[model samples]
Target: MSVLVFAEAINNKYKKSSLEVVNYGAKLASSQGSNVIVLTNASADAAAELGKYGAQKVLNFESDSLHDNKMLSQIISDVANSHNADTVILSDNSKGKSLAGRIAIKLDAAAVSSATTLPNLEDGFVVQKSLFSGKAIGHYQMKASKKVITVAGNSIGLEEMGQPVAAEAFDASAYNATVEMVETKRVEGTVPLPEAELVVSAGRGMKGPENWGIIEDLAKTLGATTACSRPVADTGWRPHHEHVGQTGIAIKPNLYIAIGISGAIQHLAGVNHSKTIVVINKDPEAPFFKAADYGIVADLFDVVPRLTEALQKFKAS
Candidate 1:
């Protein structure tokens, strides 16, 4: 049995999260002495990079309607059926999660989402997943004919296994799903936190909504997205979209900078996956300092502008 990985690409380049999934899939395939196939909804050129992640073959499907979840599910179902793939891997991003659920339903496979590690391939394919906002780990094994899993973002490393492989195009019968694509209202300057490499966040320490310009300025300079603690949204200092906590969005950016924030457990629940954390607060006893990779105990009013200026200089250099 072979493994098939769904490689998500945008603007002709594979996304970073998809790379992680491919790495995980490669390992799984290798353990079973089977080949790993990478599939993309884009053109052959788009799937060519999959070779670096250990994909033996790349399956390319070209269709505009493939962006629709219902239609895409049919295409994926067809691929899985043709290959009789034992395992199907996907990136645990929003779209991938949705597609995994739909594919599992279509194929009648046992599915697991937000998988943080490779499954134990021995007795049965038991996968480890994070639960309760990462407070707990759960292990599950698929008892169905097929298994579908979505790898969590930033949980695995991408390694170049071989040279670029030739990609083959695949054609599938399109499904007539009722969901029609309309105009897309893309939000300007709003980066998806899950996909961000760097994130600059603020907390109730900023005191008021007017003072948020400093945080926004820093984020703009660093090409990072803005996030807030729950209180910031609760107190009307920022919009709900900016909230990043247990009650809001969870992020795993490469660098997360928290300003004027006391590290609340709820806030930490969301950002605990950050590779590196920087905390700036006036209170020397702030709990966030315990978890911070770097900490500066100073008033945000004095620290933020100076930090922004330093970042500007760093960027210019």
Candidate 2:
């Protein structure tokens, strides 16, 4: 049996979450004494890069129309059957989550989504996952002969070996899709928040959107993506895509800096998974301070510009 991973790509490159999933699948495959195979909708050239992360073979599906879950599930099931895949891994992103259930049904596999840690295959297919917004952990065992796992985004570390492997093209000419291509809109220039290692997020405590220059300056200096609290997005102070909360995007960046945010539970639920949380606020008793690795109780207007200058000097050196 082999371990198969669905690696998603954007703009001709694999997304960070996809790479993390590949690394995780590689580790699991090693433990199972099986080969790792990565299936991606990227070009053959781009798919070849998966070798560095321990993929033995890369299956390149060149069609963008294959993004549909129903079509992708069927294709994935066919590939898994060919490889005799005992384990199928997917990134817990929007697309992966949607496809996991469908693929599980097609393969008659027990599926687990948002798994935080790799499965313990020696004792059965038991996987550890997060629950209740990261407040609790659950261990689940899959009884099916095959298993489907969607790994939590940013939960797995990427391991690259500085090598490349050739990719084989997958023939999908017989698959008929009901969906048509539509216009796509994307935010350009800035790093994607989902994949960013560093994130600089702000809230209503910043006073007004007109005074957002310091936030932009600091983020630019540190090569970070910018984010906002749910209220900030609702009020149009920031775009809705930048919102992070219980109802917004959940992130687990290496470094998360919060400026002027009060640390509401909804907001904390989204960002509490960050490796290091640095909170800056005028209020000394803000709830965010409890969760912060480092906290500065001062005016962001005074503290942010100085921090930006310091980072700029460091980068220039």
Each prediction's TM-score versus the true structure: 0.90, 0.96
User: lDDT scores for all predictions?
Assistant: 0.85, 0.88
- Give the Cα-based TM-score of candidate 2 against the true structure: 0.96
Candidate 1: Cα lDDT at 295: 94
Model 1 ranges off by over 4 Å: 64-67, 188-190, 312-317
Clashes of 1: 0
Query: Which digits, one per residue and each the tens of the lDDT, describe model 2 over residues 1-317?
Result: 89999888775687778888889988988887888888988889999998888788899878655457887888888999998898899989878899999988888899999998888877888998877777778899889999999998767677794378999999887887766658667778997787788999999988788988899999989999999999899999889999987899888899999999999998999899999999999999999999999999999989999899999889999
What would the per-residue lDDT of candidate 1 be over residues 196-312, giving only the tens digit for each residue? Answer: 889999988888888889988999999999889998888887888888978899988999999988999899988887999999999999999988999999999999999999999
What residue pairs clash in candidate 1, if any at all? none
Clashes of each: 0, 0
